[model samples]
Target chain A: MIAGSALYQTAVELNRRAAICIPEDARLAVGQLCQRETHSLSRYVLEQIMENYQVAVAEQRPMCADTGLPRFYAKVGNEAVVEGGMVGLEEAVRRATAEATAAIPIRPNRVHPLSRKDQNNNVGVHAPTVDYSFEPGVNWLELTVVHKGGLFGGDYRMLFPADGVAGLKRFLLDSISEFFRRGMSCQPLVVGVGIGGTKDVCVRLAKEAACLRIVGDRNPDPDIATLEEELLELGNSTGFGVMGLPGDGAILDVHIEIAYTHTGGMPIAIQHFCFAHRRATARIGADNSIEYRGNPCWFTPFYRRESISFQPA
Target chain B: MNNLEDLKLREVRLRAPLTEDDIRSLEIGDVVFLDGVLFTGREGLYSQLFDLNLQPPVDIRSLSNVTFHCSPAVNELRPGEYHIPAVSATASFRFDKYIPLLFERYDVRVIIGKGGMQKEIYQSTFRKYGAVYLTTVGYGLGALYGRGIRSVKDVHWKEELGLAQAMWVLEVENLGPFLVECNAQGRSLFEMANAEINQRFEKLYAGLPQPKLKRLGEVTSPTCEVL
Candidate 1:
């Protein structure tokens, strides 16, 4: 049986790393995007983002000031053994969140939804929210933590299935345009679109797509991948550039995650993540051994494709 | 389209109790670099400072004429001392209610944040108080902490508000490269950017043919969880 103490240790370690450094893959993608800036203002802003990452690494500071909301996605093995079961895992998360809040000193973002009371420890009602799935044969638990800063934006819509390809495109474009105009989402933006699932499933998938997927990677299905490509092109065409200045590098990538839904309704969720996209993944074996993986590989063993061109319309 | 090249730029040295002439000289799109003291605070601290009628722990008028909206991530080195670990800009629209009140009571000549503030504040309090709004590069928080800030002075509200929400008196040097968003003359950079995007959207919408949707089957009510 895995010790309860081991779980808390793992959670603290994961939170610590996710907060302090931008993932290696994100660094590579941002570097490539910076090289494509044609406008002087866009170039300046993009370069600063890169420089910020370097400083975060060098000084061991959080990559962004907004440490954001702490979210966990886990896949637990059905056969896995734990000293206290899943409840123990939940308690472990709470303890770990508190530890990290004091240690890493993440912003205490949790507050009473109505009373506006600050917990001051990043733990409150339904906080450090957890989503998990069970795999029957697996013997180890894998966890991915996504730190979504407060500035990120998202929405959900239950569209009539008849609202064909045109409706989908219109909805997506309209949302992006509104955010672009308001300068809501930070640029070198990452857009995550979820389609065809129940409303709850769609929203989670969208967040997963936004935070878990690598910047330059694509879905294995050619059709879904093509949609991602088109959206990326359309998004950049807005010329929102970096921090709402006019330029070409408005969006760095678009990710689409799909699930089968009831024919009666097509639920869609659009989630936005800033360029930081801070996340970390770790695996805990039945014997209590922990392995911290570099790349999240959340949905691995997928087909690889050539990188799409980002030419603005 | 707004052109950055045509924007008038000025380099101003920051100090407390700025003259009316200094505030008025700045206009929308002007670039500024600060060279003096500044302080940091965010939503919660604003509530405590103004709504709760708490007196500032330090002498506010002695510092520069600027205040930044940042709830920094800090690490405590000793029992009371701390070091800034990260810094980032936050939105100012929600703080609209208290900003004017702040200007009326204090000598704050310039406000800094990301995504700018509302237009009413700019047209009214900013113009009336002879103040200006500045936008820092949002993604450059780490670089800002490293290059811009020199040290953190005495911190206020650390006990109740926690580290992020606590008001910090910071000594800084060359802490800017802030874009003038709202100026004393009442021009707003955000308005120009918004208008430009709207104009461009009109063309984009007109050129594209609307996509039609076809219903495949029956309707089912969805049960969505609270996200």
Candidate 2:
């Protein structure tokens, strides 16, 4: 059985890693963007961003003070056993979040929506939301911590089938125009588009696409991959760069995730993962051996399977 | 595309409690680094000082003339002592209403934050007070900015306002890479950038069809800013 203590320890370390380290994929993408960025002002901003990333890791401090909202994604092996079951696992995560908040000194960003009461520990009702998915076979549990800024760069709309790709492109442009001006969304962003599904599902997918996926990863489906490329090109073609300054590129990449939805509606949600791009992941084996990596590897084929039954090859 | 070596931006380093001439000398797009002192403030401090009309516990002007829209990631090593590991600016547009009072009451000459206030506010409040707005580079250079902070001189209203919203008096040196978004003369670099970007929107959106359903509060004009 995987001990609760191990889970707690791993969770705390993941939070620290997420806070201080700019993942390699994101760092490389920014470095490449810096080279390609043409505008003098935007290029300077990109260079500063890269310098900030290096300083964060070297100083062992958070890359951004807004540590955003710290949250988790867990992928469980079907046969994995935990010391305290699901409740035990959740308790460990909650406890770890509070501990990491104090130790890493991440801003305690959580509070009561109405009363605005802060516990001063980044722990509160439904704070540090933990989302779970399962794999067909395996005996390890993987966790990914993402600290995404809560304000700006997210939107949802219901489009009819008649609206088609043209309408989708318009919606993408609308969201960009709304937030990209004045650099409200903090550009050189990863644009995540979630298409088809219930409203909530699409929103969740958009956030996952933005936060969970690495810089160069693409959807396995050919059609979706093509759309991702098209959107990436379109988003960068806007002549907006970092801080909405006139430049060659604003978007780092576009990730699209789809789910089956009602026949009449083609619901869509979009989320922007900013230049900060903080996320980290780890896997805990049944033997309690832990291995950390940059990519979350969240979208397993089984998780996206259309078939009712999942088979492990 | 210009070569990286060919592009050069004018960079300046200024000390706090700046004079009218100091503020006036700055122009839009000038990169700046700050020294001396600045304090952190946001909605909580604004609501208390402006909305509730509470007198500052300490004389506001005595602390510094520069104010930052930020909350650092702080650790209280012991009671009454703190360590800040990182600092970054929050979006300033949301606090636009308080700018006039801040300039009038506190004699604030420099406002540093993420993004910036609406363009008209620059022409009105900022121009009236001979103030300028500087935006943090990348808007998330928390560690780089944090390194500049020498000490947390004082913290106000931690119990009442919570850590993130409390008034933090910080002493900083070389604390920036901030870009002048709005100059003393009221010209906004972002507004100028927006004007150029907006000119391309029509062509970019030409081939795309309008949405099937329109939202009530959405801004339809490509040129109009949502803020």
Scoring only chain A, what TM-score does candidate 2 earn? Answer: 0.99
List runs of model 1 lying over 4 Å from the truth. Answer: A300-313, B5-31, B49-59, B62-64, B207-227
Candidate 1, residue A48: how far the Cα is off, in Å = 0.4
After the best TM-score superposition of candidate 2, give how far the Cα of residue B4 lies from its true spot, in angstroms: 15
Question: For candidate 2, lDDT tens digit of each residue in B1-227?
Answer: 12222324678888887777878999777788888888999999999999999988899898889999999999999999999999989999999999999999889989999998898899899998889999988887899999999999999989989999999999989989888888888988888888777878768889777787888987887778888
Give the TM-scores of the predictions, in the order they appear. Answer: 0.87, 0.98
Q: In candidate 1 chain A, where is summed lDDT lowest over 10 consecutive residues?
A: A303-312
Write the residue-wise lDDT of candidate 2 on A142-246 in tens digits. Answer: 989999897999999999899888888998989988888878888778999999999999999999999999999999999999999998988888888888788
Interface RMSD, all candidates in order, equals 6.7, 2.2
The TM-score leader among the candidates is 2
Candidate 1, residue A177: Cα displacement in angstroms equals 2.5
Distance from true location, Cα of A202 in model 2, Å: 0.4
Docking class of 2: medium
